[model samples]
Target: MEFWIIVALTSVIVTLAVAWPLLRAPKKSTELTDDYDMRVYRDQLSEVDHDLARGVLSEEEAKQVRTEVSRRVLAADASASTSAAEIRIDSSRKTNLTALAVMAVFLLGGASGTYYLIGSAGTADQPLAQRLSALQTARDNRLSQKEVETRVGNITEMEDKATDDYKKLVAKLREAVKQRPDDLRGLNFLVQNEARLGRFAAAHQAKSRAITISGSKATGTDYTDLAELMIIAAGGYVSPEAEAALAQAFAKDPEDPRARYYSGLDLAQNGRADIAYKVWINLLDEGPEDAPWIAPIRGQIADVALMAGIRLAPPPPLAGPTADQIKNAANMSEKDRRKLINGMVRQLSERLASGGGTADEWARLIRAYGVLGETEKAKKIWGEAKLKFASNAKGLGLIKEAATSAGVAD
Candidate 1:
């Protein structure tokens, strides 16, 4: 009741302030007119008399000046009445009143019309509440369905590196996963996208759920991904849980590149460099030449290999056996094929480190280092190559590309 009273009072005040001009009648101005001139003439006659009494003017001269002034005043008085009447504009007065009424209608009508179009008047009695509510409603309506999904529904939406299209895909995947939480396909997307999105915690959770859903079908890659996520989530520290995940991955696929790489890393940290050396050297011999993990393997393998009575070779150029090469060696066993590949890699590395290859070759060597996850070695090579090719723009460009690929560019 008090609110209503306040509102009613406010409305009355606004109405008066807005329409006062239309409601009031026009008043004539109190300016100098014929009547005023009569008074002014009388005052001048008195001043002339005072001047004569004080002997400032001769009696005759004062009288003559007063007479002339009186005559002019009478004429001015007649003109003043006409001038005053001419200023009274009845037509203009009516026009102004009408215009004021029209303006008041527009101002009040606009306010009411705006309220009716978007206001919550029909829903509630509180007139002021709609103003705040409208703002919130507008903001809520601004977000597209896809935007909402990307911001909240999908874990991968948080990844800074993900493309907008990719983020949308992740959002759709999130919706699908929500609908079927037990689906392996959904969980797989959840794992991969989440990791790519850099949300390691979510990635680990998704990987765990995936393993649970997959049961015995969960592959080494899945477990490895989970372990890697765990390591990342723990800020590169291989926690006990990560250790467990790594073991599980090894159990499923002992030859998994990432799994073997991380295992070697852990082993080296645990003062088992000899074992780590064996693990990495074997990975180099069998793993895909372009694998991301191989760079790190090739980089750190040297120290451990030396400690384990083995020579760690320099990184080879980024190349692997061609289909033709494999076909030519088809008569050889799988072990032989791998051995030949490893030997080729070893030969290339030796040439890069000592045989003084071309600028392109050096760049290839750096790229190979990157592929093997040997960022430090790649950086070192980059420094040396810069000195060698400082004046050569083409060579420098190649080296820059290689360094960038290796994750070693300054």
Candidate 2:
């Protein structure tokens, strides 16, 4: 577009230059051609005056014809000077100027529109680096979308086919990884599925290859995660070297919560409950309040508590009625129901405050209250359960009960 605009402007200049000379040349040429004629007419007029002055003819005849001859000579000169060439040149110049103006308008207008249209894609308000980044991002997104679609198709094919299906999937995924070694999706899928099929060694090999392929391939968190999964798939055994890998990853990035969580799992699995207990307790302190890992983390804590024989405060007995005593309560009068509830609540309250109930016992006690519809007593138990089981689901049966009791509608 820029090249064409320059060419057009150059052409316009050339046209104007060529046409200016042509338009002016005709008039100049006509004047030169008529010079001799004008000179002859002037001489003839002078000769007539001379003839009349020298008594060659009457003064009256000279005077009468002088004005007429002068008029005819001026008219003839005007006709000769303004020739067809001059009229044609003048008309051509006018046409050329009109064309040049039109061309200028179109060239500038088209260029301006094109400039803005191209510029509007990113906008000048953005830095050049940012524009380039955005362009790369958009291109990558398009390519990634296509890749995901292809992978979905591959997954469908794998689902439908049955002949060494897992191996075939791995082969295809390996080929894709080879085609785009930097692509994490193919490598990750390959490793996960290989592990799923109990091919831990192969998955480890693929992960190692991927780590080699992309120079900056192994992130601390991802590397530890993959290595740990490999170790688990390898029948829960790993060498000192494998341990060193996790230690190195943690050293490289100590702040990664997953690394911390898995480290605790490894400690627990290896029967270092003391170390595991310490690690998990610290993890609970450092991790997000609602981390899903907390469920397993708290379960481990409860297991530790059981190992140490640390018992929680016993929950109150069933208030109002027991689940099995529902018919008994129904058979009794309204007064009996109130008496039964008061006795149960008092006994349960004493036990809960005394602190000797196991986790399971608390769950059963709360469930008993719920079955009897002693909701007020159940709600109290539920609140206490939430605190006791803040991290573990076992103690949190009360939260569900609490929600139902509040009538907030699931």
lDDT for each residue of candidate 2 in 1-410, tens digit (9 for 90 to 100): 66557756875776567556444533335542456766777787888899998999698888876777798788777766677567777787777677767765776667657766775533337786886687556533332222322332222222333368656867787788779877766787787776655455566667766666655656786667655654544333333434555786786688767667667665554445567677777877776755655645654575664553555443344344557688788788988887786677566655554442445555555655665666656656655554344334544554555446443212
Candidate 1 on 176-220: residue-level lDDT in tens? 998999998778878877767756677788889889988898888
lDDT of 2: 0.59
What lDDT does each candidate get? 0.69, 0.59
What's each prediction's clash count?
A: 7, 5
| Per-residue error (Å), model 1, residue 63 | 99
The TM-score measured for candidate 1 stands at: 0.37
How far does residue 288 in candidate 1 sit from its true spot (Å)? 4.3
Best by TM-score: 1
**Clashing pairs in model 1, backbone N/Cα/C closer than 3 A:** 294-372, 295-372, 295-373, 295-374, 296-372, 296-373, 296-374
